[model samples]
Target: MSDLTRRAVIGASATGLAATVVAVGPPATAAPAPAAAVQPVTRGAALYRRGRFAKRRTRAFWVAGPGVRLSMKLVAVTDLSSGGARGSLRSFELTFRARRRGPEQGTYTVSRSQFAATSLFLVPTDASRRTYRAVVNNR
Candidate 1:
């Protein structure tokens, strides 16, 4: 064979071998999605205390403007009282669970500064439920 033709044949064979090795290798596995960062927060506390706890989920602006985004928050409140309080001032140790979804388009974020008050909300009882749902179009 001519020197140039032999070199070209060798190069083509090497490329074909590399391609076959890649194709025959174990199937590529997709990376697992990262876990979402979450922090439970108190919502509509004062109103709740005054016997005005919103029982249903909150819906955001759909009619206000050409909303690119609509957000809703549902904070399920439960009275964890087993019996009457021993003292005159009756107050049960309260826990909060907050779930917020839909804020702008690509991403949703909430910082501590936005909240009026924040503390470590421990919920061993699992008294609240949080959820998020998205669809391509209104349904």
Candidate 2:
């Protein structure tokens, strides 16, 4: 944020009024956000579902956060394009669950193929919950 816009937001917040600033061009003032309205969040937010998940060519993802106690599992794995005509692969799609009491992490290790891909699906259990995607790099 720029100086002018930051000042405006602060000023409006002090007066208990909503303020909006255009992130594209020069700063412009608008009304403040609603008391119970949902707002869009940017990357690297401290949310538990997706703290700082980013897609990569090598790794599926490396994400971690604190949502009190949490559980993790390899829900699904799909190989859309494979050079080999037919073959069995390795995966713990089910019957794999790890629980953490404090900070937790969701990651993977790809040893057989050079690359693997999956979507980090998330359901909004609460108003702050969200979905995320990850990438794993072994090269």
Candidate 3:
């Protein structure tokens, strides 16, 4: 081939080989998640901040079931914090009042409009069987 034609062919072949290598190369490492992309706390004491539930006292939360949704009122919030700091909560209890009876004692999906659904283990507290309580103990 002519010198100019030979150089052009070599350049084209190099470009083609680089493209093929990239197309068949190993997967690239993913960039780390941004600060704003922080994941939601699914389980733990961190998920149960006393302020979130205390401020919503008297509001309603829905208890999700297999085929039904039960409305329960957040009747009270008792701060059982370990008193380690001014506002730090180590433990707390949430009391909910349901109009009708629900499952005796088990983990059910509890949801509120202000936040995502969360699983909570509720137990009937009173003989009337209308009040339910869930304790989130971090201490």
| Model 2 whole-model lDDT (C-alpha atoms) | 0.30
- Per-residue lDDT for 4-107 in model 2, tens only? 78888888786653223333556679888785453233232132121112122223232223222243443333221323222223211111222322122343
Which runs of model 1 end up more than 4 angstroms from their true locations?
A: 6-24, 37-103, 106-139
Computed on alpha carbons, the lDDT of every model, listed in order, comes to 0.34, 0.30, 0.76
Instruction: In angstroms, give how far residue 62 of model 2 lies from its true place.
Output: 15
lDDT over C-alpha atoms for residue 97 of model 2: 26
Q: Give the TM-score of candidate 3.
A: 0.59
TM-score per candidate, chains pooled: 0.22, 0.18, 0.59
Could you give candidate 3's per-residue lDDT for residues 1-139 as a string of tens digits? 5466888899999999999999999888999988645433357554578887877899999986545478999898886434434444656778999999766666777888867677777888988768998977765
Alpha-carbon error at 39 in model 1, in Å?
15
Which 10-residue span in candidate 1 carries the lowest summed lDDT? 130-139
On lDDT, the leading prediction is 3
What is the C-alpha local distance difference test score of candidate 1?
Answer: 0.34
Per-residue lDDT over 64-123 for candidate 1, one digit per residue giving the tens place of the 0 to 100 score: 112322233433333334453322122333322234332222223222222333222232
